[model samples]
Target: MAIMLSGHVIGLLKEYMQDLVEQARQETSAQERFGFAATVYRPDHAISDLLALLDDRIESEGMQVGLPEGFLHEIWSLCNQASVHVADRVYVESNVGSEAGSKARTRELTYRALLAFIEARGRASAQGEQGVMES
Candidate 1:
């Protein structure tokens, strides 16, 4: 059975994914600015620590950070339900008789859906910010 994801769920997923992408972008930008050092005093240090700090700042206000285990569990459970629902509604079984092919198709569909969601959310966020600036 194929799962059908609603417009709202897709939208939410896209928004969430976009936020993650933007966060990664910002982290990269920050790293470019602050990652290098004049001296190799601490070459053993990981860039991940710096990235984590940047991520923390990015999500400091009006955003969630380091969600508790219980909250994460709940969110995962909900996401699983949503995925199942969507898969059942939209996924079509391949007649090629190849399990790998079916799995690949499903993965492709999932990735495309995620990308669409991210693009939509990024555009909406940009528009909202632009509106705020114009006001």
Candidate 2:
């Protein structure tokens, strides 16, 4: 069964994702201005960053934020499950588009893919429950 997350958890995830995206944007801007790129950044890097942020948040203010118990483990599992798919989508999006891609774009695409995966998972889980109820 797909794991269910509260709206608050998703909200926090989105906020963290945006933070990473903005960081990528700043890094990309610096690289452009300085003519030197930092270490290669990829979707997996972004995922790991999100996981790290989640870990810190859980450790710091999980109860205050109403994050359920095991939220970190659940999100880690979800990220592991979605990682390949998110990476693939980000790759296709960054490469297939006519627009030039930057670190920020890559992060945005990765986050979008991950969010889409989670939403789809939630929908599938809800549908499965409904089917069981009807059976």
Candidate 3:
């Protein structure tokens, strides 16, 4: 069975993902400014970053924010399920630029892939609901 997330939960997730993406951008910019070597980044790293964020949020403000119980686990499972799809999307985008900003680009691509997965799931769930209602 698939875990369904409500609009509120999805909204919160988007916010969290944006925060991570922005943090990556800042980190990349700082590294470039400081002449630090760019570290190799990939979709798996982005997924781990998101899962870490979710874990922290669930521990810190899960109840206050009205996150459903098992939310973190559910998201973890979803990430695993979507991993290949996300990685493919990220890989298709040519990584042919300065390595300094590659981390930020990877993060953005990963976030977008995850967002697309969530959106597709939401639509499918909605359509299923509609079908049931019509039945």
Which candidate comes out best when scored by TM-score? 2
- Misplaced by over 4 Å in model 2 are none
Report, for all candidates in order, the number of backbone clashes.
12, 0, 0
Model 1 TM-score, 2 decimals:
0.31
Per-residue CA lDDT of candidate 3, range 1-135, in tens?
Answer: 677898899999989989998898899789989999888899999999999999998899999998998888888888998999999988876355444337778888888998899889879988998999999
Off by over 4 Å in 1: 1-101
lDDT of 1 by residue, 30-83 (tens): 665987433221111212222343345445621343333243333334334445
Q: Score residue 128 of candidate 2 by CA lDDT.
A: 90
Better of 1 and 2 by lDDT: 2
lDDT of each: 0.41, 0.86, 0.87
Give the range where candidate 1 is weakest over 10 consecutive residues by summed lDDT: 39-48
Residue 6 deviation, candidate 2, in Å? 1.5
How do these models rank on lDDT, best leading? Answer: 3, 2, 1
**79: Cα error in model 1, Å:** 7.3
Candidate 2: 10-residue stretch with minimal lDDT: 37-46
* Tens digit of per-residue lDDT, candidate 2, span 68-101: 8888889889989999999999989888888666
